[model samples]
Target: MESFNAGDVAEKIMAAIQKEYKELKTLNVMVLGKTGVGKSTLINNMFSEKLADTGIGKPVTDKIRKIEKPDFPLAIYDTPGLELGGQNVVNALLADVTEEIKKGISSGDIGKMIHCIWYCISTPSHRFEQTEVDFLKAFLNQTSLINVPVIVVLTQSYSKADARSLTAEIEKENLPIVKVVPVLAEDYEIDEEYVAKAFGLDTLSEIINNVIPEAVKKTFIAVQCANLEIKKRRAQAIVATAAITAAATGAIPIPFSDAALLVPEQITMIGSITAVFGIRLEKGTIYAILSATIGTAGTTILGRTVVSNLLKLIPVAGSVAGGIISGATAAALTAALGEAYITILARVVKGEMNVKDISTAKGKKEIARIFKDLLKIKRDNNGTAIESEIETSADNTNSFEIND
Candidate 1:
């Protein structure tokens, strides 16, 4: 049988990942509030990108501005802060926003349309004026007709009591909003002695996640930085899919020379997992990490030698037996690689490890140690001594290879 070409498998996996990444539609959010309500700060803190810095608000109309980063997957529509005194000014602003929404809907792409609206109110203001209330009610009524979810954000909240009071007052009016969320967005300095700590970011992120459509949830998860659990869950799903792919590839019963085919799947799995952590690594970096942890060249030789020896011991020349051994080995190895990378990334995300250290000799040694331990455990649990022995041989060799 022809040896599996690991390079071709790796290319296919990378191409799939890139295609999926590109296909995810951008998440467009409409942020409505008067100026200085922390809209820019909230967006910058909640997402991986510092959108506020790059977000140059282009006027969609006289009052509505669209803030977009070039080639980014998230866009924000910022409306002028409602002025209390002029009824005509408020009406024109509202009309302009409505017209923009209509245009998005007419485009026939829900992804191009505003996914949700965040109506922000500053908590320090203590209470909403009647005009603010009236404007919000009118805006909500207009948006509701098109099924866009509007969430009320109480920004710059200092205390729980203030947040509760504001929420109660809004609820008393019973405006048509998806929910009322109190968020601090960022830490604030009250004086030389006191500071208002940030809070409610996670709750606000969860509400947004729940309100957005399932089709765009992955995009949201990729961009949002407030919720780590959501990222972890998504990463786990990617790892599971990779494990399945590795198992399928192994079922071909190719010879030891072809064992390299499994490397690409594991590498792709690592790349996907890294993305969930919001880290962008170069292709060279990814391959280097894999080589340091898994002994790229040694793993194939070891896996093949071990599997071939096991078949000899069984006195079985059948391909089914060979397929079973290879499939189990691939699944076990891929799972181990994925789980190890996940653990390392979780630590990096949690500030337990320095991301720069990943390229260091000491860091690579630690990763190799964790990967070997996990691989051994997986093989032991699955009753695959041959697989475990292969991992042991790879570990002993400690030979890193860069395939051309």
Candidate 2:
């Protein structure tokens, strides 16, 4: 018997399981934290709903309550906030979500996986108790929930710069920092940019209006648009060349700094190239290779171009010879690739042939025929060779041949 590695076999098993259970869609999230830290507030902000009670002075939530929404259905189980020296909050949360899943299996509403774990913490600086630290310690030890994506919602705080330091400390200690959000429930004029960033949305307004009423939603959306637009426009002005080079190369060392500054300019240059040649390549697909090559060559070429040009102006080599072109060609290539990428993207957005032909009748029939043909793949009489041997014995030689 042949042996297979656990990982390879497990991957095949998982693929089979996924195909078998494809109907399961909604992602259930379990929110756990100390009371009064704003788990309810976070959910309300997420769904644009006032369903979860806010301004609760104390830990009013006692049981695991489910918070559901329209566009995104969240079986948000809000467990009782962790106490200073009482029952462990992590245990309570895990138990609750596990029970919910069990009940769901019977009730036919079980979600496939736990999508998010929003661990609401007010501010680690203010509440760095031994209990919290121990809880965190145990939290990381539990590998059972490793598959679930967790985000530490640092609520009731301000300034991303400050958040960065806090996040760095946690990361240094090896804590999973999916996202850090500083939210103020009282101001309720929530910064949608942070929300959009945390949730991976193109625009913040898309999420805001759905939560607030028509009149208030309109006002909030307008203000958010203005604020975000101003930030975007200002970003569009300065081109951080070194940062762009780093981004292109994939040696992005900065943590808190934005990748946007570097990416867009490179993207624009690549887009230009794509447009000219009518050929497209994803910046992401070729970013590292191009960035590495272009950064080195471009740097050299640019240096020589300056030297050559300067030498030409001099009486000795005036117009006879010029400095080596450090960046001209590499820069041009980057620009061309960027342009081509953009043109391709635009065509993609306009609905070109971007979809896989898996649903076509001919394709389906071909797949079915292939599967039917697989039945022909049989072991030889010796059974030593695993080959596509469609046998046609004398008794049943009606007319059968192997089809490719």
Candidate 3:
């Protein structure tokens, strides 16, 4: 009989993670701005990996460089400070940028294409200079044919009044840009008396999500760290789909010995969630989660191990048949597992927990507690079809909160 030992299950999940990640289409973005506009800070805070500081930046052209991390599915075409000393220099920079976009278009690969552009201005400047306006006019006219979306990012906007003033100024120009967004990418200390908290990057992230092609969104969500709600919505959708599939797989009662039947769906769900959160996971971490949540810390199979352990840890589940489990039972169990894992990953994303702790004794205990707790809430009785868990209803909001 086919069975998934904990080691085998862990290997399967890791393989699935690799497969899903590699399958993601690379997302390409172009950022243009003068120096001191806080572009690096904005980039680092908005994405999962610090693509600005940590990525390998090599000159794609004398004026533009491509920043990329190894095996990461994102390419940021970055420009050096745009002093805009002369019309000729601005024209040269525009030429280099457009040529690069043209190359991506010629390749006929969407991954090679430039999906979006950001033109950042320091809000403290308080005025959108005429030189910058002329450059934007020419740049907009040049890229109009290619249909690239450009967003004017007002960076270092610690003062709401200053940000709003600059925003109105830019809006008056009415270049065909996407929108004018003001962002305080990181907290700023004005003095002993005042500090400005980071804001508006989530709005920027959501705006980008709305504009980018559907093909690149999977990679976008996986790599973006600014918006937890985006990641949660995607993870919850994965859980709902996996739950429905698990229900179908167990529609007919299966003996406990055959519980391995539901293992594949659950493994895929776990892999996809990891990809979405874009968290680094070592094999031991995955093994720890499996051991703590599914069974005791030794050789384990999804079938008998889950039912027997839940019976031990949860008294309300006492009524389930010892030898066999129903479809409703399978769906609830799978949904609980998916939701539990989502909560763990969300905590890691928010810095409330660390991935390194997953292998620790305390971490393992907390994980088990979350899994059992979810199982208690997600228990289904009527074998009803599972719907998406992302409804605005308040009930779900409390259940998935990242605990301290």
List model 1 lDDT by residue over 289-387, tens digit each: 554554442244325544443233221122335344565556656666677677777777778778777767766766766665555553422223334
Ranking by lDDT: 3, 1, 2
| Alpha carbon deviation, residue 53, candidate 3 (Å) | 2.5
Per residue, candidate 3 scores C-alpha lDDT tens digits across 1-404 of 65547777788899999999999999999999997788888889888789899899999888898999998999998897577888889889989999998999899999999998999999988899989999999999877889988899999999999999999999998889899999999999999899999999999999998888899998999999899899988998998888788777764443344353336788899999999999879889999988777755655455554555564433234555646556666777777788889989998999978999888987887887777666656345422323433322223323321221
Mark the regions of model 2 whose C-alpha exceeds 4 Å error after superposition: 1-24, 53-62, 69-72, 87-112, 124-127, 143-146, 159-162, 176-404
| Model 1 lowest lDDT segment of ten | 310-319
> Model 2 over residues 1-404: C-alpha lDDT tens digits?
22222233223333432332232245455677777776676656544234365322223134566655443223466665455456565566545555554454456433534445566677535544566666765564452344444566566554445456665555566665454445544333346644413331223224333433332322232222212332222222211232234234532221102232124444443332222222223323232223222121122211233323322322222332122212222222232233223332333333542423223433223222322232233322211114533332223322211111
Q: What TM-score would candidate 1 get against the native?
A: 0.80
Q: TM-scores of the models, in the given order?
A: 0.80, 0.36, 0.89
All predictions: root-mean-square deviation over Cα?
A: 6.0, 24.8, 4.7
Which candidate, 2 or 3, would have the higher TM-score against the true structure? 3
Q: Which run of 10 residues does model 3 get worst, by summed lDDT?
A: 395-404
Considering every candidate listed, which one attains the maximal TM-score?
3
Error of 3 at 194 (Å): 1.3
Candidate 3 residue-wise lDDT at 220: 94
